[model samples]
Target: MYSAFKIGKKFLHYYFTAANGKGHGVHSPFVFDLITKVLNDTTNHPAYTEVEEQRRLLLQNETVLTVEDFGAGSTKGLTKQRVVKQIAATSLKPKKYAQLLFRLVNYFQPKQILELGTSLGITTAYLAKANTNAVVTTMEGSAAIAAVAQEQFDALQLKNVNADTGNFDETLPELISKPESAFDFVFIDGNHRKEPTLRYFEQLLAKAINDTVFVFDDIHWSAEMEEAWEELKQHPQVTLTIDLFFIGLVFLRKEQKEREHFVIRF
Candidate 1:
């Protein structure tokens, strides 16, 4: 009962804290345009429908599994013993976030992509569909979820996506240390703690291209996450950031001298 109450409180806090329309009086032309286009995109695409169908299917399967959490679990009292269907139903990607990622992957056509979390691989599939030639490396801390996602990838024939199951903190360092370590697009959705998020941000900065795009999930999930978002936005290399409450999009465009930030309502 206390866990339920805490979740309710967190939801209310987030709902009330979010800035309404006009994105807190944002002034950047590019950000404003991005807000109007990506965040506020109302039309449903075919890809979104496919993803939604898959999500529904995952939710219907009442299979139970033991989950290995590499980061802090958002839910209270969550243990290794949990229902697979429950996780799929309660922890899949939001529609707004899915659309945002779809648009980003479609627009940028990034040759290489790195995703921190592959919870069921819904977001990974969405990103892979955008550019077939794009190599998408999605890391999952749980072998159980990774197994399910790998099956999904096989059924979808998404050959470009590589769903690797392991401890991200340990694997990321080894991967980044390699000579060919560079990613055009990155999504950070693993660790929700401020320190780990900041550490990952700093470590990934070394592999960033001048025009790399980094997307962080659950930026407003907690005060610490929000603080991490703020710190990341203020980084010297970051020139643009778009806050959609749930996700924070970062851009490192060297061509732009001034930094721009926007809060768009979806």
Candidate 2:
């Protein structure tokens, strides 16, 4: 993960170099539609308040759990025990981006969704609530954390989600190999290291279809993550790539004539 100063510098560079959030000069019809309809959409769904209220309760909770670090450890360093509120504060995605994910899934309406992380299930709630018809499979490493996330899902009545708790290396491959595991939408947030991130992408490629969309979180979190993002952009199967500073979206649309990459301000 990047330091505060480094992250600030990168944001400045991204803000200046990236395209405007509005669909102004974007020429690609698909990307233009995304910018206009999904990325920039401001409609506040009822789920937003409901999910955020759960987050508030989590922030005030003082329970501590034993955590297992399977990926690159946190920037602040990892420990055997961590507070629920601290994990909620640092690990969970903010409401802005989480809601944007909800809108993206709500608009695209992917039937099968896979999430690589389930930290407290806040983002999972957003994804599951977005499309009641879509089935969401979320993976988490720690049993204790996964329990908390499952409780959150139960409280929200998000029946569409299935939380799988284990090391991603052990759980992801098994899930992907299943006969019914054809994911049209995937969120890669479990591991932050370069090799693991790229490995997950490659594994997911076998399950992808022409219209599958994969979103990677914390793309610019570190130099290695940026390297991984660049390598993913060059992948032959990926038709289009969108960089939104904090997240990177990859599209595998067979209708595209040529591969293109866009950095859009969000």
Give me the candidate number with maximum TM-score: 2
Model 2: how far is 51 from its true place, Å? 0.4
1-266 per-residue lDDT for model 1 (tens digits) = 12557656755665676555554465666666666665666767777777777787888877888887777654432447768688887777876677679888887789989999898888998999878899999998888888888877886778899777788778889888988879999999888888889898899999999878999988877778878889999999899887766788899998877887756555
Q: Which runs of model 2 end up more than 4 angstroms from their true locations?
A: 74-79
Structure candidate 1, residue pairs in collision = none
* Inter-residue clash pairs, candidate 2: none
Q: Candidate 2, after superposition: displacement of residue 166 in Å?
A: 0.4
What tens-digit string does per-residue lDDT give for candidate 2 at 1-266? 78989999999999998999997899999999999999988888999999999999999889989888787865322548999999999889999899989998998999999999898999999999999999999999888999999889989998899889988888988988898789899999999999999999999998988888899999999999999999999998988999999999999998999899999999
lDDT at position 117, candidate 1: 89
| TM agreement with the true structure for every prediction | 0.87, 0.97
lDDT on C-alpha atoms for all candidate structures: 0.80, 0.92
Error of 2 at 35 (Å): 0.5
The lowest-lDDT stretch of 10 consecutive residues in candidate 1 is 70-79
